[model samples]
Target: MPRLRANDIEQDKIARFERIKKAITALEKQQKQILKQGDLAPEGAWVARYQVSQNRKKYWYYKLQVPTPSLPCATSSKLSKYKHLGKAGTQEHIDAVMSVFRRSVWDEIQRIIHTLDDCLLDISSGSEQEEEEAQD
Candidate 1:
C-alpha cells in the first residue's frame, strides 16, 4: 500500500474541520431558538423561595414545587441563587423570579443538547468522508 501524501491529508483534515464547524454552528443556533421558546416549564407550576447557606454566606434559592400524592405538600428543593440577593427574602429582590428559573433551566438543557448534537454530527460526517475517500 502507498502512504498518503502530506498535502492530501491536510486537505482532508481541513475539509472535515469545516464540515464539523458548520454543523456545530447550525446546532448552536437551533439550541438558542429552543431555549428562547421557553416552553420547558409547565404552566401554573408553583415556584418556591428559600434560603441556603454556602461557605457561611446565606444565599437565596428558588425551586419549582410540584404537588405530589405521597408528600401531600409542596416541598422546596434548592435550585439556584438569585442574581441580586445573596439570601432568601433579602432587601435586594429580583423581578420575575420564576421567569429567571425557567430561563436558566431552558438554557442549560439547550447547551447540553447542542453540545451532544454537534459532537455526533462531527463524528458522523468525519467517518462518512473517511469511508468515501477509502473507497476511491
Candidate 2:
C-alpha cells in the first residue's frame, strides 16, 4: 500500500467537521423542543426571587444558577457557587445563554481547523521547495 498524501488526510478531516456542523445544527433545532418538554432544565435550575435595595424598594427577578466547582487554587473554603445566568422566564434570555455556549464550541472548532490549515500549508510549501531544489 502507498503512503497517504496530505490531501487525503485533509479530506477526512473536512468530512468529519462537516458531520460536526450537522450535529450542531440538529442540537440548535432541538433547543426549543427540549425547553418545551422540560428536558433542558436537567442541565441547570432557575429562580424568581425578591430583593430589597438600599432605597427600600422590592423587586422580583429571575436568575439561572448552575453549580460548578470553584477555582483550583482558591483561598476560600467554599466549594462552589451558583453561576448567574441571564434573566430567566423568557425565551430570549434562554436563547442568549444557549448562544453563548454554542459560540464557544464553534469558536474552538474554528481554531482547530485554522491550526490544521496552517500546518498543511507549511508541509506543502516545504515539499514544493524541496522539489524545486532538486530540479535546479
Best lDDT goes to which candidate? 1
Tens digit per residue, CA lDDT, model 1, 1-136: 8888989877876776677677667767765775675444343334567777799998667554444422222235543222223334443323234454665665665677677566667655665355444563
Error of 2 at 135 (Å): 30
lDDT of each: 0.55, 0.50
Measured with C-alpha atoms, the lDDT of residue 8 in candidate 2 is 93
- Deviation in Å, model 1, residue 7 alpha carbon: 0.2
TM-score of 2: 0.35
Give lDDT: candidate 1, residue 59: 66
Off-target runs (Cα >4 Å) in candidate 2 are 1-86, 127-136
lDDT of 2 by residue, 1-136 (tens): 9987989977865675566556555655555444454323313333324454566765555443445543122355665434343345567466545644554454555566566556555544554235444563
